[model samples]
Target: MKRTAAALAALSAIVLTSGLVPQAKAEEKKPYKIYLSNNFVGNDWRQQMLRIADTVVKKAPLAGRVDLKVENVETTTQAQINSLNNIIRTKPDAILIDVGSPTALNPTIEKACAAGILVITFDQVATADCAYKVESDWSMLPAVQAEWIAEKIGGKGKVFVDRGLAGAPISEQLQSGFEKVLKNYPGIEIVGYFNGNYALGPEQEGVASLLAAHPQVDAILTQGYGSGAIKALQDAGRPLVPVAGGGYNTASLVCAQTEGAQCILETNPAYLSAEALKLAVDILDGKEAKEKHVFVYGPFLSTDPQPSKLYPDVKMQKIEVGTNAFPDLAPGLSLPITPDWVEITPQEAAGS
Candidate 1:
């Protein structure tokens, strides 16, 4: 079985570049071909997802059992459709995709699955017929991270947000999460929310611009690339503002470890991917997979300096899971977690 799977992977890769054995003959083996369609490109988080996909492609214990192909095309609805159309043409045994929207991606996704292609989703997903999903509790965390920030700041101050892409679900969900928190504290005013577009240079520059615009910006809120925000804020010569955000990175963890920043709460999407892939393989092996979605529960919350500690639910004391995942305590910088705030710096978001 292992030999057959490996050969199939090699053969499938070859089939794409140069057709050998003819299409009819290639179909005879009915190989387990796997396609991974990643969402977004350029951001550290996106890169992390690709890194994990690469590791699985290279090192799955039954590597080559299926032909594994990967495509990362930034986060655009059209790109998603294009990948779907291409995968449909190939008619692979399975496709693992990171969705671009919860609602719009359904049509193409259903079309592929209706053609009998096995489908699974990671990162973000649509509401349609995904066989299963490997995702975190994204709908809840933005508020959780925000609530923490509000608590630390005593819920009374002006907060600026280095936001995410305008329409993406991550930006919306996390933004709402923070909004819910703000509702609890009427004293906290949102000064600005800039769509950072998940790029470090822009996110950082935006933070600098906001700092220049609002000298009294009490706290900065963001999701991904916040180092630039910190650099901008600190450069302006204000006392280091407390920051909070997410992503598992060495820089964020180092920030927490060094006590230079505030919070760096993050999720290990690799675990989510590993679990999701296991479900995909199980279906291939003719086992019962109970549901269409699976949620991985975790994120590193490194808060404050010496007072900061990992969440009680996830205590990784010696190894310290809360390391770079926090901002102010992240050895450097952080963000106030919000949904629409879709920028990040993933120095530690490892794939494998």
Candidate 2:
């Protein structure tokens, strides 16, 4: 009887030990090596990019199952091309390139793919081929901004575009959207000129030259900070110009509150990163996807009668892009599309 009881106890212990070992092995998942290639680092957008990297690392289900290698190559196209080439030699499982032109980066992407490395795109999308594409429809910003302006300016005004670079995708797509909206309201006269250098100096100079070209500029519509237009307006004693921009941010919040600018729209960038990371992980996990262009999302729209309310403490503007456009994810590092704007009202400016 004593031997039988001892044997039963030993058998139970063995089963328990075996179960725990498998559990421990499952918990101690292997790490995944992911390479991230960043194209531009000096802009406000890039700050969000870094935040996205951090968010993905913290939020991914695989957690320790993934490792990151990040590299930024200023804004030079050649630098991006070279840096990506070098990273490819390391043969990471996946790489995300925040690019400006898809075609220019296509050859390199092809080589990386040939090496069995999955590639994805974010931010300034390259014209190159990749496994996934994540970003807001850049083509939509121009029309979206124009739509907001048309609503504000009552569908008729002489507006000048402080656009992005002449032929750049951002500039081109935004311009196309704006043009589409313009056709709807022929009363809205486009006082053309000004490129989005995405730099303060070029942005400012572009607006300055624009003011010179079109003295009767009713309102200035731009892509970046819109600092140039504002400076030109203020320096020239131009009372107020109703301007709308996509990169609506804290400074824009301050400027809007002080009646420096008008409507500012912000599309949260973290969503882009999270989406890009999600896809990258999927590809790494040996899953097969049918398409390459995987669009994550864009911004949310927040409108406060007084843009000043955002001063001191800013929060994500709840965008009304509809709930159906989202995917299911757990709490914590969940990225929401808060791409809305709080317009500095005409009354606010009038008082200022």
Residues 239-312, candidate 2, lDDT per residue (tens digit)? Answer: 66666654434324434444535654545354466567667877777788766776544443334322222122
Instruction: Write down the TM-score for model 1.
Output: 0.76
Candidate 1 on 235-337: residue-level lDDT in tens?
7877666675555344355444544566545443543444555567679878887777776665445554222221334422221444324432323222212
For all candidates, the clash counts are 52, 23
Model 1, position 44, has a per-residue lDDT of 57
In terms of lDDT, model 2 sits at 0.62
Off by over 4 Å in 1: 1-31, 248-250, 257-260, 268-272, 305-352
